[model samples]
Structure formats: C-alpha cells, structure tokens
Target: DESIDIPYFGELNGIQLVNPIWVKAVPYNVKVVGANNNVVTHLRLWSTEPSKKQLVQDEKYLKMVSKISESLYPDDSTDEGKILRLQQQYLFSSAGIQDAIREHKALGRDIKDLPKYYTFQINDTHPTLIIPELMRILMDEEYMGYDEAWSIVTQVAAYTNHTILAEALEKWNIELFKRLLPRIYQIVEEMDRRFRLFLKGKNLSQDKINHMALIGSHDVRMAHICIYGSFSVNGVAALHTNILKEIELNDFYQIYPEKFNNKTNGVTHRRWLMHINPELVNILDKTVKGNWRKDLSAIKELENFKDDESIQKEIKNMKLAKKRQLIDVIYKDTGVKLDENAIFDIQIKRLHEYKRQSLNIFHVIYLYLRLKKDANFRKTFHPQNFIFGAKAAPSYIMAKYIIEIINRAAQIINNDPETKDLLKVVFVQNYNVTYAEYLFPAADLSEQISTASKEASGTGNMKFMVNGAITIGTMDGANVEIVEYAGIENEIIFGLSAEEVTQAYKANSYNPRKIFDNDKRIQDVFKFIKSLDKDEHYFDFVFNNLLNVDYFFVLADFDAYVEAQSRANKLYQDEKTWWRMSIMNIANAGFFSSDRTIKQYNEEIWHLDTIKL
Candidate 1:
C-alpha cells in the first residue's frame, strides 16, 4: 500500500482496495460526490486488479481466503508493518497537499482558499501521522515556514477514534519511529517539546507529562488527538460516551470535558431490516400502517398494539418463517437438520475470551450434565437449538480450541439418541458480516453475555434487538443503553456492572477455583473436560488455559449463566409473553439505529449537513 514517494497520496477505502476478493457490493453504484463544489480534488487509488497483485505477492494468503472469499493479510503486521502503514499515511497526506498546490497553480485559484477546500478527515489513527506528514509537505516539500505549515495542517485535518481496546490502539516503538518516519518523528518531537512548554507555564505534573507523551507518541494518543485536535469528537454509544469521560479519558475529560461527546452507533436499517427480512417488513408495514424504512422512530407506532393478540400472532408467525429459512441455510452448510420449533438460541461474534465463549460453554455443559443425571429435566423444558457462529483470529490458539470443543460437543450431543430431540448444538463456521444478516433476524435469543467492562460496544446486540430478538446480556457495551431503550422487562440482563468489575479487579476478589469446586454443575462441566481423560490433548488444551491461565473468571460466572439460561427457557415456554417481549424490543430499537448516531454526530461533532444528491 506504500513506498517512499516523490508525489502526494491519500487513502484507498479498505473494501475498494481489496475488491471482489471477499463479499462485494454486487451491483456497484458510481457515486460522484460533487460535479461543481469549486473546492478540491481527491483520487481514490486501487490496483484495479488487486487480487492479481495479492496472488503475485503472497500465494499462501490468496489460497487461505479462497473458501470463504476472505483474506488474512499481515504484510503490515510487525514493526515493519507499522512502518509500512505510516508510510502509506504520509504518501496520501503529502500527495493531497501537493495535489492541492498543483491544482491551484493550474486553475489560478486564491491560495488562502486552502483552509475552506482542504479539510481532511483521517478516518482512524492508522493515518494519524498524516498531520506530521502534511507538515512535511508544507515545510519540506511545499517549502512553507514551520509555523505556517503547522497552522495549515491543523486547520486542514481531523480524526476519528474506532476502538478503546489496548491492543487495537497502536503505538510505534521509538526506534521504529526513527527508522521509518524520521522527518515526521522530528516534527512530533518538536510538537511534544512545545506542548511541554505550554503545559509548564500552566503548572503541569510529571504524571500528566508521561500520560500525554504516551498518548501522542508515534503510536498516537488517537482518541485524544482526534478529540482535542479536531473540531469535535464522539463515541459510538451513549454509555460508551459517558464511559469515555468516566473511565478511558477521565484525565483528559477533566482537562477538556466538553470535547468528548456521544454519537451512538447505528446499522443501516435498510440492510439489517428491510433487505434481510422483507416478509416481516411487509407485515410491519401493513399492521403498523407506515414504512418505518426511512425513519426508524416510526417503529414507535408499534407501541399502540403491544397488547393486540392478532398482531402478536402475526409477528410470531413471521419470526417462525424466518427461522425456517435459516434452517434451510443450516442444512446446506453444516448438514444439521434443525427443528425450527426449538428455541433458536444464538451467539455470533468474533471469538475473543472477553466476549466469554467460556461462560456460554460452561452453561451448555451444565445443561448437558443435568439432562444426563436427572431424567425428567427434559419433560419440563422446551427443546433448545443452541447455535454458535464464530471465527477465531487464525493465530489465537485458545479461540481455535474453543471452536473445536464446540464442534466436538455438537457431535457428542447431537448423535446421542436420548438428547437428539431435546438438545442440539451446532457451531457454524466462518462468521462474517454477510452471514450475520441471516443470523440476526432468525435468532430467538441474542446472547450478549460478555463479562461487564470487556466489550467496548457490541453492534451485534443492537442488530438482533432491532430484528425483534430478546437479548440476554450483561451490563456492558451497548447493552446498558439497549436495556434502557427496550426497558428492563422487554430484555433480560444478568451479571456484574462495569463499576463492579473494576472494583473486583482492584480488590482482587474473584476466585475461579472456589466457584468451580463448590457448584457441582460447574464442577461437572470442568470434570467433564478433564474426564475426557480419554482425550488428553483436548482436555489439556481446555484445562491449561482455564484452570492454569484462569484469567477471564469463566468459572466464577458459570452458575449465574446456567441460572439465566434456565430463566430464558422458562420464558420461552410462555408463547404469548415471549411474543409481546419481542415486539416491544423492535418497537423500542429505533434509538440504536446508525441514523440516530449519524444525526447526533452531525449535530454535535462533524456538523455535516446532508448532501443527499
């Protein structure tokens, strides 16, 4: 994507750059942003034949993505990768600045208009050095004075923060910084020095200095730089917004409180709701009496008929039909014959420990053991089709093992005649955005049981809720705001609060061993893994990670999850009650739409006016 260049460059949208390689926008629409803005020109560059370039460079990677049409790219994975990414940033930044100068020279436009026409939004910190890069164009390439270029860079550009996870946040080593981006490093050092002097007169402390240095270090204190340097900054959820201030950015919040804002994330309801489930959409349009398609707040009209039995029956039938369609998909992909009558319990997301597949698996094993021991446990319960869709990061060993265990458990439970009808487990492979559309609408239950404070904000939870699935979640991510929107009774919430998790960590109060030893169900689940004494490698894989590493407190939450799952099953048996709850969830889900989030951003941060044309 990058090389040392004589000219300026900008960016290639990730999708466009990796085109037709994975899932593609089938019928492409050519969108021209402006025919006559009298402003600036930006070129989006791609290899036109990108897959050929990819295959020529890495035949191994090209082969990996063939089955699912997905690629595992790590050309920029190391310190070298970081350097390559930074080089791409500067390439685009300097190119854009110089491109602006060239256009001005040809067109004979006033040079001062650069500020008005040259505003650049660095989508994420992957391009954070762009400010310094732009500075180089002005001072070194453009040969403008230091202060003059710095002024132009500041006025011309801003950034966005994508994630709060520690690993996802990037920071370059000082050595990497010096080797790959020497000139930009000099500009950053100078900026750090000047900022230090500014802080010195204001009576700054050492702690603040260390914090800011790490924040703006070549790795980039991205959210802060985006927030403080840009005209505005915002988070993807209401709770996340408050969280940014209360936790992640507490120091900076005090330093500059008003800068951080909330622009809750939203999905394009067009893709999520309309295109995916046109049948349910038809029923909604007929019953609710308007197209909620354009403005989701119109779903509020559904509140009037929450108690209407006829409408409730229609919604229930519509959901069941969608479930039947999903079963067709399941049959083709995994050769698993699923009963649509069984409760479609689902958990689909990236396979990360913090998302707590361990807790969910413990609950599944606990149920399996209970059924094995108590013969009559089946009579009282509705049969459940526990469906999991996840893809582990190829290098994440524990996550890959988790998938294998889930597959093995599915084989064990599904093949046994006694449990075949009552309980079925299926692990669908290669979970991605395209498959998520099918999973969201077909789900009877959305499992969002991440340990509190771990998931930054789950966009998936909102998607399922909007599709009328009941969420059984924790008080983390967007779930807090979701339960608030849908109201408590409309959804089910379990487990600790973010504050409680933080306090527990501070006190060192959690004990996975004690929890595992006392609860026989949890104990049996662990014992079941170890009792696979027959399968030493698999048990060793599970045990060494759980009992030895034991960091995520999987054992601690196992019982609570079993209790929650049991409660959910009991609710599932009450057909009328479940239908009403599902209705109310969709009715209240308007708040979670990206339309609302974008509107909030346009109002509070970007101040972008709609350019519908």
Candidate 2:
C-alpha cells in the first residue's frame, strides 16, 4: 500500500468537520495483470485510515472513526445509518479536497489559479458535498470572498448523473445535515439562497424555482446542488442524457443547456476481452494482424473473416471451452452441473426492481412450463442454462425477496426430472468481480432486459458484447448505443422503447392485471410461483407488486421478452449464423472501450493537458 499524508480537520474556526480525527490515506495500487501474468497497468485506489494514536482512543470514538471508511451505502433505514452515510461522504470529500489544495500549493501554484491546474469530477450525488466543502475551504481558510470562491469551485468541478431513479439521487435531512457539519451546512444554505435569487431573476416561476432548489423544504437535494454548482453535468449514455434533458432533470437542463452532455459508459477491453478470454484474443491477433489492444477500432477488421468457416469453427471452439470452464466452476461452487452444450444465457447485476431479475425468472418459468406441456417445443427446443448472479442490498426487502425467488426457482427447475436436462437454472451465490471473470466470457446471450428507460449506461452490456455475447435486451440505456455499434441484426432487441415507456408513465395507461389476465403464459408462470411454497404464499408480495404497482412494467414487456428469447433460442440452433453474429458483436465492440470514454471526457469536459511519466 502507498501512504499519502491527508490533512484532517476536526475543527476549522470552531466548526467541527465530518470525522473529528486526523487520518492517513493508505491507498493500495490495484494491478491489472495481463493473460501472460505481467502487470499491464496500475489503478491506485484511495482509502481512509485513522492515525495510530486514534486507534488507541476510547472505543466509542474509534468505532465512530472506523464507520467513516467502512462498507459503502450502509443500511439507511435508521437515523444512525443516515448519519454514517452522510459522514462517510463528507469524510472522503473533505480529505480529497484538502489533499488536492495542499498538493497544488506545494507546487507553488496560486490559490486563485487552482481551477487552471486541477479539476474535480464528481462521479455522482454522493460527492455533491465537495462543492460546498471546497467553497468553505476557499472562503474560510484561503480568505477569499464568497463570489470568488464560488467562481473557482464552479470552474473546477463537474458532475455526472448516473441514474434516473428518484430514490438513488441522494437527499439529506436538513436537521441532520446541520447538526453534523455546521459550517458546511451554513455554506450550502447561502449557496442555495443565492441560486434561488439567481433563478428568480431569470423570470422562472416559483414552482420551477422550488423544484430546482438545492435546499428543499425539509432536506438538501444533492443532485440540485451538483447541477447548480458544477459547470458540466453529463449522463452516462446517449439515451440517458436525452432522458435527463427531456424528462428527469428538464428544469435544470432548460436553464443550463450548454452544461449538459453525453459520455456513454464503457468497460476496459484489455481486462474484459484480453485477460478474460485469452483464446479469443489469440484468434483475433492471428486474424486481424493489427495493434487492436492499443487502438480497439482495429478489432473491426475481424468482420472480414466473419463468414470464413475456419474462423467460425475456431470461435465456436473457444466459446465451448469457456462454457466448459464455467460449468466446472458452477459445479464446484453450487453443486449444480451446467450443460456445456446448452446456451449459456446470463443476467448478472445488482438485484434491483428496475433491472428486472423477476422478469428474467418469469421467462424461465414460462419456458419450463412450455417444455412440460408442449410436445413440439419439447422436441425442437434447444437446451439452455439460465444463469443469474446478483446481490441485493441488505435493507431492500423486495430485492432480497427476488433473490430468494430466483434461488427457489433454480432449485425447483434444476431438480425437475422432466425439464432438468433441457432447461437448467443456476443462481451463483455471492456474485462479485471474481465470478464475473468466468461469467462474462462464457455467456452466449447477455440479458440487458431491464424495463425501458430505467438503467443508466450499463458497463456489463459492453463487457458481454466485447467478449462476443449476443444481447437480448430492451432498447434502454447503453443497449441503444450497443445496437448502433454492433448492428440491429446482430442483437435481439425487445420490449417498450424509452419514449413509449415514458409516455405510458406520463399517461398512466399501463395496467399489469389486465396483461396478466390476458396472457395464459404469464398466468402459468405465476401459478408455478404460488406452488413454490405450500404453507404460505411467500411470493404474494411480488405478485401483488406486479399487479398493483408494476413500477417497472415487467408484465407489460413480458410477451415481447418471451418472443425475443424464442428468437435467440432459434438463432442459437443455427451454428453458422450464431457464430457470425458473435463475431460481429466482438468486432463492433471497439466503440464501447473505456479508452474511448476517457478520451471523450478529457476532450469535451476536462481539457486537462497530458503529461508524460
């Protein structure tokens, strides 16, 4: 671990800081090792550590200090959890700003020229406190005027909005915020008052002004602070950015049009492609004959050999090898032997209602029922191993229920004599980064099947595409950009468009009960869910949520998703066509590289000069 001295402030002019103790920044460098076991690069990950003296203090203080650097997003169901989460945010943000300023001044750069020498990227609402924190430091410590400090803060900071979900955009209770950090609260209150006056001067209505207020009636809206404070506000994908402008944050976008932009999220091709699937990398190396690793656009040259029988055979073999490796891992981990020959359809992400883990399982139940009842389907159906990997948040009861249901469904489906061979379900426990190394490369079908307009740009979709998995997804988030890059024919696009979903929500026209009653397939799936537990209707909460609320339109998109799955199943039967599409997906995936995403951020927003090591 590399240690850096972090100037911690317990009090600045009689104001208590977030964590009232001096701490050390002991960050370890995460090595990105290549397939050949050589360290390709290093990603320095920063973390907090209390001083040795503080470690020997009273138990209560040590516990409080430790909570600051503990696991992220702790259960905020109680007041204590909320305070800890807020404290964690301030702890990191305050330390980071202090470190940056110290480093800048140590280099003999003037405080007024801080914006020219450095820029801060506020990744999301979690770091929104940085704006006010910076303002406080400049005004109090550097003795700058409020206007000058605000000017410097605006120029140095930028924000990225990663979600459209209201719950995900953080807000702190005003009382709690004020009680914890009095000085920071004071600065934020003044900033809010100033911004409100600025908005009123623009002739905006009071309702609009209130809607865009940083400090609301009872709470401090973090996103509002970010939008008003930062010079640039970007979304993670093309569709996501458009949604923010038109629907989610339209008020802010209308006022600050020039600040809004799009930078579709991406995954590292070197780690996702080269390290994860070295066999595929070797094949591409032989066929493309270019430095595809350095300039991923060179990977598109593989399109020339897409139709070649020899290349197709090689790709098929590589995929099968990966599947076999995954099968062994699943057997070791879960004691469920996956069929290497079966289509490896994977949906792995955070367990959330919008991401629709329930929707995926509903389709699995439908297929299981079809195999039992339909003779033609039993004869003609291609075998499939439906794999799921996810971890629900501790406090999210519904998400946790979905995980239980997926596992319960897996248990029933895998043990069934009638469908065990043809259809197998495997929910890998404790899904994390290590398991993802196996899951991404082995996938035959990547399920980006969230309800329309829900997901921010999903890097998982890009990871699956780069590793040659055909996507069966809704036209949402980065899936839209994936289709544009990989071609529509190469992917299985389904469900409501983002605009249609938005219109449905706006019109309040969606009725899940009607769709459930109309569709016999959906009814059969629910029947299976009901039968999973005889003593009680354990999953009735899920059923009720779907019928009563259906916030994500799972029932509305059910028929379309099933049809798309059928199409993918049939397409998988044709070896030549499947391999060709897989090749095409890999070739076109160069556009979704992290290298491309970073380049765009530097060119458009940051404009930081490149320096040689």
Name the top TM-score candidate.
Answer: 2
lDDT of each: 0.69, 0.88
Candidate 1 TM-score to native: 0.84
Score residue 447 of candidate 1 by CA lDDT: 96
- Residue-level lDDT tens digits of model 1 in 1-613: 2212222112224211222122111112244443234444345431111233232336643333232112223345565445545544444455455555666657776554566555566665655666766666667555688778767666666555555566655666666665555555667767667656666666779778667653354354544444444554556666666766787767767766655666667777877888898877976787676658778888878878778888888888878988988888888889898988999999998888888887887677777877877877878878888889897655678887777678777887888887788888888766778778788999989999887777767888988987889999888878988888888898878877778777877788877666656777766776776554476565676676666546666766666677788889999889789988998998988887788876776565545556553
- TM-score per prediction, in order, is 0.84, 0.94
List, in order, the clash count of every candidate structure.
Answer: 13, 0
What tens-digit string does per-residue lDDT give for candidate 2 at 1-613? 3354333334445543544445565556687764344437765556666666343567766677677677887888899999888877887787678877877988999999998887799998998889999998998889999999999999999999999999989999998988777788889989999999999999999998888999999999999999999999999999999999999999888899999999999888878988889999999999997789888989999999889999999998999999998999999999999888999999999989999989999999999988988989989899999999998878999998888878888898899999899999989977899899999999999999988899988999999998899999999999999999889999999999998999998899989999999999999898888888884578888899999989999999999999999999999999999999999999999999888999999999999886433
* Deviation in Å, model 1, residue 341 alpha carbon: 0.4
In the order shown, the candidates' Cα RMSDs to the true structure are 6.9, 2.9
Best model per lDDT? 2
